[model samples]
Target: MTYLDKFPTATLLVIALTLGLAPFVPEPHIWEKIKMLLAGTLARPVDIFDLLFHGFPWILLALKLTRQATRPN
Candidate 1:
């Protein structure tokens, strides 16, 4: 098992808080893109990239936690 498998909850929390919640002075680029998405704006190349970049960690962490929960102890 990798380090992520060993510490899925901690890993998820850190990623979620850092990438999803923490505010920046100018605000995060991903946050702006996410707002655009919510407002029904067309996605630009950079917006797509920003979404994927910020979203990948959450996707990975959720998958890890789901796998861990369903696995037999």
Candidate 2:
């Protein structure tokens, strides 16, 4: 079967976006308290690599979906 027949594109996009975004969701904000306890030590860099890694796929998928949605089937 072809790609469209194999999966609903919107469902795939939601799943992909959810999985891609899973890492960056702050952990219930409880970690803020922990950080305070530790005096904000062990600071993690704003992982630019991770940002790009997670970001590009979603942007591409969005663009693809937009193009497909707007175009006549």
Candidate 3:
């Protein structure tokens, strides 16, 4: 079967939680935070792309779980 055939709700929920929490979590490294700020200021498009790609894996995982949960006996 496909990825969706595998943890649907949990996968979706975890991803949702992480994404929601990301903004609130302060960067531990000063340099990393600076880089993130600069990237947001300069390469805005890249940041959007990064967000999309980052969610992909989670979506796939969710789909897999949905598939598995619905799998036939």
Candidate 4:
């Protein structure tokens, strides 16, 4: 197993905490940028970077989980 498979729990926890709870904090910048993106208003370079910074980990975790689920036992 590679590093990703070895740390599935950690990845899941990060996904849950970041995407689930982080947005509730005062002035959640990443969440705001995501909303702007969905509303077709995200254009600033820093906002784009913030989106990628917070989003890439979730995407990778999702991909890892999907791969693990699809793998034959």
Taking all chains together, each candidate's TM-score versus the true structure is 0.63, 0.45, 0.42, 0.70
- CA RMSD of all predictions: 3.2, 8.3, 7.7, 2.8
lDDT of 2 by residue, 30-68 (tens): 334344436754344444444445555566567667767
TM-score preference between candidates 3 and 4, better one:
4
- Cα misplacement distance, residue 35 of candidate 2 (Å): 18
Clashing residue pairs in candidate 1 (N, C-alpha, C atoms within 3 angstroms): none
Residue range 1-73, candidate 4, lDDT tens digits: 4777777667576775676445666756567877899999999898788788777666777878787899899
Q: Judge candidate 2 at residue 53 and give its lDDT.
A: 54
- Model 3 deviation from the true structure expressed as Cα RMSD, one decimal place: 7.7
Tell me the TM-score of model 2. 0.45
lDDT of candidate 1 over 30-68, digit per residue (tens):
677678899988368876877787777777778787888
Q: Residue 46 error for model 2, in Å?
A: 7.5
For model 4, the stretches where C-alpha displacement exceeds 4 angstroms are 15-24
Q: On residues 8-67, what C-alpha lDDT tens digit does candidate 3 reach at each position? A: 567666765665335544642323434676676535676556555555655666666666
Candidate 1 weakest lDDT stretch, 10 residues: 20-29
